[model samples]
Target: MELHNVDLNLLVVFDHLLRLRTVSGAAKALGLSQPAVSNALARLRRIFDDDLFVRSAKGMLPTPLAQELAEPVSYALEALQNALNRKVSFDPRHSDRDFRLAMTDIGEIHFIPRLMGTLRELAPGVSVATVRNTAVNLAEEMSQGKVDLAVGHLPELTSEFFQRRLFRQRYVCMFRPGHALDKRTIRLRDFLEADHVVVTAAGTGHARADEILARQGVQRRIRLRVPHFAALADIVASTDLIATVTHKFAERSAKYFGLRYVKHPVDLPEIQINLFWHSRYHRDPANQWLRTQVFDLFSE
Candidate 1:
């Protein structure tokens, strides 16, 4: 209970436990073993005079006291980490630091190669790690400095985080070569009649394109639903289901999958792909350098 006796590192373990809600999961996230996480949990319980988290059928359930402690602990840790980061000057060329990013598979497809190419030329000592586990709360991830940059359209990321609209992408419907609808522009009538495959990249069944379609009172028959865009091309190529995807990805499918892409008939709103970072690192020189690299690469 004494502030002087508490190890600041224990707070990090407590924070991860709250976020993941499981000792094993927190251990994996923090790169620690299960025994280590269990020991940390025991220490946290002794410090708080509470069970902190209880094992349940679902997962580790946080006690009321633990719930109360989560926010303030996260904030204090982030602030301290931010102050410490600012004290050291970042030299990209010589600093062997790990730069982490949270991005979707689509963002990996679009950005990683060229970005890494540039990094090799400019900052060879910098290593990159991509985090694809969408289950983690992104706002918490960024605020805690676990993630440096997040790529994609996440409307949920607002207020505390700083966001930059990297680019906007238009929708295109794709089908295999020699399909009945492959030759020309698809009309709204054809679009509605087609059996469609929807890509729910965020695991939210509804997409921005679908919202636009609903506004227009047009409901296409959804035949298949996939979790990622990368899985769509093969499914579309092999099956009769047509998928509406971004033009950039559709172009790749056309060339690699032997599929054909056409403009979607209904006026679908362009999807905004953004880059997000925590405001805590807004003035950090290394973060600023990384931000500049992203903008300069895709600013067009």
Candidate 2:
């Protein structure tokens, strides 16, 4: 395809289709009629000489060629958007922008409340949405701009993304104030014997706590598993289940939910929570401002 003959608008359609996966979904996302989106997709297919997307039980699955083009197309559209909106300054007080964040339940519990309060004071019209973090293809999701920012202990983050260390957190043992273990400091032996409430957001599989225990040739009996920190904390506060959670979360819950915490028996590694964004948005003025605000709020 000649550069002069290629219609740039098709790139926007392609990006939308890649994200939404269905023609109707893409049309809705782009605010275009289905016929219009279909026409654009047809043009894109002819130019690329690929079907691009094939119908499947799980909606429109992208062909390998489409998958290969996804990131570049998204990046190009983002660049074009930035270029066209170069004069627009992000005035949080007046702008009605929605910032989407990918974070763990712990992050939502400890950070979002304070962050939203700050936003209320500084950027009243701005909104926030949180997506749960999963242990799969996080970099790809960030690259596609499905999430504006991601905050967690993401060991899988690629160097292609830009990241900032938000804060370092230690783990603590949590239980109801009057649980059997409340009167004494927890020991490694006690931890191994007690029933634990494990927060496995991604699923019931390997977790940091389990890995630490495995290193010592000890395993805790996980009586319950939950998907979010909030749920784990709630169960620990109301029941006899003990949970190991970030110190930030434990402390916050202690203050808010009348929960109690004690030092864990084993020396668990300190978890470093970082904020990540796609490199494509690293220099974006609005994103930069928001990132700075988030870092400042959380670091404090």
Candidate 3:
């Protein structure tokens, strides 16, 4: 296709349509009328010589070619946006940029309260959406601008991701007050014998803590494998079930739940919880400001 044959703006529409999976959503996000977005979609189809999206009961479904175009088109548009918006100053006190983040439930519970306390004073206009729907494709989502940042021990950080280490995360055993092992110092044997409630890996059936334990040849009775840390608090407070959680989260959980924490008897290496973003957004001013706030929050 010739350079003049393609309109770059249509690619922006396509990118949003793919991200949102609906023409009306793309229209709303792009500040364009639904007919305008529909017109752009029609032009995109003719230009690419393919039906870019199919109207579905769910939403607009991208064709294989449109799916293939999603990445590079998104990258190009973001790079162009960054170039154009580079000098745009970010005033947190007044700017209403909505930051989308991909964070685990543990990170959300552990960080949001403190982060919001500061934001409420400094960046009241700024809003946030911490999305968990993209955990399986976090790196891709960040690169595409679907997620602005992510926090946690992201084992998926590859070359595509840029991360800044925030804090080293260590595990602790938490249980109700006056449980079987409450007064006694926990031995590795006692921990292994206790029934436990574990948080499964996001978007999967396995739990990283369990995987680590299994690698060390430790056998424990897993009474439940939940998908989030929020659920563990109630279960641990009522049953013989003990929970292994990151030290910070465990410490925080103790404030609300009648729980006590002890050092994990086994020598599990500390994992670093880092702030991660796509390299594509490295130079974006709003993203830079948000990242700075996150760094400051944890550093203090």
Candidate 4:
């Protein structure tokens, strides 16, 4: 019962014995010799004053005392293992880590394919999960480590977070290729006269496109309002509606969607896309590796 009398190795031996139920099995599990496992068990018996496991024809069966200590010992050992891994260096080539990212729908379209390709080549064992930045309590989720990283133009992730700029992109007006306004330069009159499909992507900086135009006293004939950028291409491709979106997204999606994009007439400022992480994970080896991969892959 003395605080400093117990050997930590004995607990390791005891835990393996309870699970494997044999001295030889415990020794193999712990990479120790059978005699070493037996010696540790003997010390454990002296410390606890009980025969922890009894030999039998079937296998080594645990005594009631061993059964009582089994759950707590396993939990303690697992907790210690997690603590060590948190401070240890991360090896992406061999790590089977699952990381969660916060992004908009446009981000999923523009970032996932390239990101996944890079990960498949560099860290085959690592996996990814994505959550929309509009999720409830997103800030709190990142703070408590539920979310690993947030990528895009997220002005909300300001304080208590560290961010690195990946790139800056301007908004461009996109429409079907053969539409009436297919000229190289779009006039302000033509832009305002055309029916528009506005993306009200709340909780994202993309929404600023409409705000910037409105402040400049430029208003387009609103034909549709969608919540995400996913359907914008298909809708604009099949109709005469114009959609203003980030240049990177427009450039990537134009070919597949069969749409054409031109510079905005209202002079919208470029939005800087950033990679953000909670301050708590700023020094984590795994997080640092992930951040570096993203920056190298996309930063301009």
lDDT of 1 by residue, 120-222 (tens): 9999999899987376788898888888888777878888889887888888888988877886797878878889888776532126677667788888899
**Under the 3 Å rule for N, CA and C atoms, how many clashes does model 1 have?**
0
Supply candidate 4's per-residue lDDT for 82: 90
All candidates' TM-scores? 0.66, 0.68, 0.68, 0.71
Question: 1-300, model 4: which lDDT tens digit per residue?
Answer: 874888888888888888888889988888999999888989889999999899999778999999999999899989988998875689989999999999998999988899999999989999999999887588899999999999988888888999999999988888898998887888989988999998898767787777778888886799899988778888998988888888988887677876888888878899999999999999999999999988998899
How many clashes in candidate 2? 0
lDDT per prediction? 0.84, 0.81, 0.83, 0.88
Q: Point to the candidate with the largest lDDT.
A: 4
Q: Please provide, for model 2 over 1-300, each residue's C-alpha lDDT reduced to its tens digit, 9 standing for 90 to 100.
A: 677898888888888888888999989988989999999989988999999998898988899999998888888889988998878467878889888888766677777889999999999999998876674466777788767888888777777788898888777888888787885687777777778888765521227766777788777787887766656666777788888777887888888889888887888778788888999888777788889998998773
Off by more than 4 A, model 3: 1-86, 133-136, 203-206
For every candidate, C-alpha RMSD to the true structure in Å: 18.2, 16.7, 16.3, 9.0
Tens-digit per-residue lDDT, 90-172, candidate 3: 89998988888877787789889999898899999999989874354777788889889888777767798788989887888
lDDT of 1 at 192: 82
Off by over 4 Å in 4: 1-87
Model 2 compared with the native: what TM-score?
0.68
TM-score of predicted structure 3: 0.68
Tell me how candidate 3 scores on lDDT. Answer: 0.83
Stretches of model 1 off by over 4 angstroms after superposition: 1-87, 203-206
**Which residue window of length 10 is worst by lDDT in model 3?**
201-210
